[model samples]
Target: MRLIEKVWFRGHPAKWLLVPLLLPLTLLFYFISALRRALFTVGLKKSVTLTAPVIVVGNIGIGGNGKTPMVIYLVELTRQLGFKPGVISRGYGGNAPHYPYLLKEDTSANIAGDEPVLIHQRCQVPVAVGSNRIASAQLLIEQGCNVIISDDGLQHYRLARALELIVVDAKRLFGNGFLLPAGPLREGRWRLNKSDLVIFNGSPNTELWPRKLTTPNAIMQLTAKVVCNIKTGERITLSTFVQNNPQVNAIAGIGDPQRFFDTLSAQQLCLNNTQSFVDHHAFCLDDFSHFNDNIPLLMTEKDAVKCYGFSQAHWWYLPVDTRFSAIEQQKITELLITKLAV
Candidate 1:
């Protein structure tokens, strides 16, 4: 294993030795995070209220918990309710330096980030990415978007939100359950209590402390859907793919590659080989040399942004859409309307 991976699994002796010295800094981070939250609660720190309702979909964990899919699903739901929805993101891994730049069709992934671009393309809504989500939300409002959906801004206390939706990776709820350098949690699991709704991307797990989002008239259920290729822009049912092909190459460059692989397996699609890369990895021509011309290459839509200029013909991207029950959709819609009324 690589040195970093080794240290991640087993703490380095040096890391332990520095723990005594790092203790103060770690405490400082915790205090700051807590202070920000307290300020929001006490109204000391002002949260910018948009003219429209703002629904935030985010996670306390450091990595992905199906936030993008949930955001897309919410966008569709809001549209069905006759509301024009706009999206705002921090553009986590983008080169755009502007505070609030409106995303256009020509916006590159490097500038607007892969998620924003994917959301814009799929949802067909106004999208903006910036360092300050509040500023981006304002820009979307100026564009006449009555409902703003934040892609991932749970910990971003600056942006005032009407409704907050927390997504958990049901499969890997909380890795190690420690905070920051200690583990993967960006905030305590108890923070889920503050969210308007808690969504489990995989399976429902209520054994954890705060329990499920089972408040008076809350919604809970597993939302599942199959993946498909984006090259032809058509949905390829998992059942059809599995019945025809026994072995396939699976490529994923998301926060959790294993989740995608496991989902494919659940559909009975046998993966002969798998390649996992860092989240938002850019694929170039050299990266495609591993596969023969005849072999099929499948990847997530996020990875397809970087592969657009490539000449490879076998490469395809699987586009997955989220599905929610009618009751869940109604609850979200009502919450949004309530927030907007304020």
Candidate 2:
């Protein structure tokens, strides 16, 4: 684990040890961020609005809270309602040559960013990435997308949004409620009030959720049932893997690796060992030189995208899908219809 990550997620007294040092810096960040927002609010900075309604699926905290899955779910949901949806992302770690990079299934994670590529592959919709989100959205609009979903752009005030949906990690739930260096929050707790909807990526603990949030909320459960071979694309159910009782090693390079590990454990898959890397860690064959060829290696689908050409036949990745209650689904559909009608 990275040193800062260890300090940030250590919990209790251990985590509190760094607070005194980080607090002053946090206040400075808070002030600067607030000023920026005010600039946009008062029209000193312009927020570009598209011809089509744009919805932003983002988070208040730093790490992932099932945002990509929720974005994919929205893509499918909007399609069912007869709107052509396109996705625009910030492309955080990608090193593309220029702005507004339209992603293809064969696009390298090194160039188009991992999440954007995964969204394109799974959702089969128009996907574009750039630092300038407005330009990216315009590209999607040119592709005939009637609705645009900004995958993680809550902080991008320059892109005007019709609805802002915030996804929270139920377990962490804003993490100490401090901003920037001191805590996980990118914005203040009060910012939740500005959202049109709030969704907990896991079971919600009312005690942990911010009291300031009054928006209608929902819960989503992510489940992984089958693991597919990265090289040959063969799938084996968790039940089948458990029946064989073979030794397996798990690997994850996500914002929260423990969540993936716990999910596997819940499915009764015995993990002989596990390895975790920093989120979006680029992989190479040298990273796996020590592992034996016969032992099966399990990984998350996001990590699988980076390991494509160098992957072994024994290596497999599990794909997870989000599940929402029927009532909640109807509520979202109705809400979208109502918002777009305006």
RMSD of each: 3.4, 1.6
Q: Please, what are the lDDT tens digits per residue for candidate 1 over residues 1-342?
A: 223322333465555554456457657778989988899889998877768888999888766678898888889878887888999998877888576989988888888888999999888899998878888988998999999999988898877788888988776677655566555678877788778878877655557554554532333332334345544545666566666667778788887787778866776777777888887886677876776666667777778876676645566666777765788667767776676663
Residue by residue across 1-342, what tens digits does model 2's lDDT show? 665566666565656578888999999999999999999988999999899899999998886689999999999988988999999998877988888999876788899888888899888899999989999999999999999999999999999999888998887677677888888889977777789888988887767643656888889999777779999989888689767755788888898898888988888778888888888888898988777787888888888888897999889888999898999888888888888773
At residue 70, give the lDDT of candidate 1: 82
Give the residue spans of candidate 2 off by over 4 A: 12-16, 209-212
Model 2: residue 36 alpha-carbon error in angstroms: 0.9
Candidate 2: worst-modelled 10 consecutive residues by lDDT: 3-12
Which candidate has the highest TM-score of all? 2
What's the count of clashing pairs in each model shown? Answer: 1, 0
